[model samples]
Structure formats: C-alpha cells, structure tokens
Target: MTDSALAPIDALLRTHIAEYPGFPTPGVLFRDITPLLRDAAALRTVIQHWKTLIPEGIEYIVGTEARGFVLGAPLAYEIGAGFIPVRKAGKLPGNPAGLSYDLEYGSARIEIPENSLPAGARTLVVDDLLATGGTAAATLELVRRFDVEVLGATFLIELAGLAGRDQLPGVPLTAVWTIQD
Candidate 1:
C-alpha cells in the first residue's frame, strides 16, 4: 500500500477507534471501530488499502459474521468478486456447513452456506477484527469445506500481542490497523 494510503487511514483509526476497558470482562480493552465505519473517507481508505493488498483472480470474498459483513460485502463489490457469508451458527436460513471453535473469551461456531463455491475457487476471508483467531480459523475451515482455496484472510484491525495469527497457520492474513497490547 502507498504511504499516502497508510498515513491518512492510520491517523483516522488512531483518532476515532474507541477503547472500552473491562469490556465483556475485566482486564480487556475493546477497540471499537464504529466511528471509523461512520467516517466515509476513512472507510473508503480502508477499502482502498485492501484493494492494493488483494491479489488478482479472487473469485469470491467470504466475510465473517457481524462486523465482517459491514466491510467484506463492500470490498467484494469494489473488487468485482462474489460475496459469500460466514455467519454464526443458527443465524443462517437453510442448512449450512458449520464448525465449532474456541475464542479468546469462550467457544463459538461459524457457518457458511452449503456449496457456496466450486473446488479451487480463490476466496479471501475477511472480518472486522482479529482478536484470537478462533472465528477466522473456523471460517477458513468452513470455506475449505466447499473445496475452495482461501487466498487469504484480511481484517480491519489486528490486536497485536494476542498472537491470534498463531491459530491460522499457513494462511496469509492482512490487517489494515494494528494495535499493540
């Protein structure tokens, strides 16, 4: 990504990403991106950064549930890729392929639409944040069930020092903003 792309976006993120201490539990600092999402230019810069990182021939963009849906759908559209959803179990209509996994806080499951892609289709997995890699790993496994090759996993933010990337071995992961703990 260009220095022009990184500077402005990182500045906006540093300024607007809210920190909630003792969230979901004590000793936790939650970096909320709601303000970044609300800023059109910052949001655009985020996608623009992804545009530079995303390799060509990505047939589909697979987004993790909740926040990923916010960024992934738009990124897929901007990059001319089909959007595939990876959601929380029981949240999807009809039967889907699901995988249960552990998160930094607790256990959770993620599911993808059955037969979403043909074998070997290049897909990029996306989410808003990577905290412990549980959800991202689960989503990656679910996506592989469809026999597609996951090009990479991308995130809007990465909580450094958590080592979430350890859970996702052999997979390329990119995060636009990184906060060291």
Candidate 2:
C-alpha cells in the first residue's frame, strides 16, 4: 500500500502499542503490542496490511519463537499456508535444523523442526518485532535448512536506526510500523 493509504493504520498501531521504560533491563525501552493483540479490529487491520504484502504461492509462514507464533499463525491461516515455528534451543520435539548466532549480550540458537517445510516450498519469515535482527537472521538461516524458497520477511513493527534490516541483507522486508528509535 502507498504511504498515504497506510497512515490511518499506522496511527492506530502507534496508539495501541504501549511503551515501558527500562523493561527487561535498565536503559532499554520496550514497545508492547499486547493491546493491539487484544483488539480484534486492530489485529485484523494488521493482518490485512501484511496479507497485501505477501506474494502468491506462499506455502508456509515461518515464525520466530514466541511472538512470531502469535502473528504468523493467523497470517498463515488467512493466506492458506502452513505455519512453522523457529524455536529457541531445545524447544523443538525432534532433531530440528538449528543455527547459532550472537546476540547483543551473548550467543543464542534457534531451530526449525525437521520435515517442517518440504523442499522448494515458498515461505515467508515473520515476527512481531525486529530490533537488532540477530534472532531474525538466525531464524532465516534455520528456515533455509529446509531448502525452501524464502519469499520475504515481515514484521508488525521495526525498531529503525538499529540496522536490523542490515542483517537481513537481500530479503524483501515489510513492516507495518517503522518506529524511529
């Protein structure tokens, strides 16, 4: 959608997102979308915007562990695609494809369950938020293990100026809201 067309949704999202100062740690501000998730109209609006960004023939939506599941599952259902979770280390049931990456404070790992997406399946990576992109990048790598074609990545919100998009490199990225940090 055009920038002007998205203004109302953008404004709606800005109001729905609650801010918490020094959350999870000191010196960090957190953007919370729980309010948006609770409001059906707001949630539907977000899904609609994201749906428009999706390419045809997306076989699956691979969501990051936790919040991604919240967003991706519905998008997958709406788009008639399967949903796969990129889990944190040891969160999967079987021997899943895994990738280790470095976070701001330490190292971390994410996994995609074995036999999740068939080879050559077209997939989209999705998440609630994109900050530093360490987790998102690792999730992308883990999804690639299935040998599927990644159509693109999408986020409900992107914390701009952190260069999270840099980690994604050549992938097409669409964010419902890009918040300057």
Which candidate wins on lDDT? Answer: 2
Q: Candidates' TM-scores?
A: 0.93, 0.94
lDDT (Cα atoms) of all candidates against the true structure: 0.85, 0.88
For model 2, how does the per-residue alpha-carbon lDDT over 57-90 read when each residue is reduced to its tens digit? 9989999878899999999999999998888889
What is the model-wide C-alpha lDDT for candidate 1?
0.85
Please give, for residues 41-68, the per-residue lDDT of candidate 1 as tens digits: 8788778777777778898999887888
Please list the residue runs of candidate 2 whose C-alpha ends up more than 4 Å from where it truly belongs after superposition: none
| Candidate 1 residue spans exceeding 4 A from truth | 1-5
Q: What are the C-alpha RMSDs, in order, of all predicted structures?
A: 1.6, 1.3
| Model 1, residue 137: C-alpha shift (Å) | 0.9
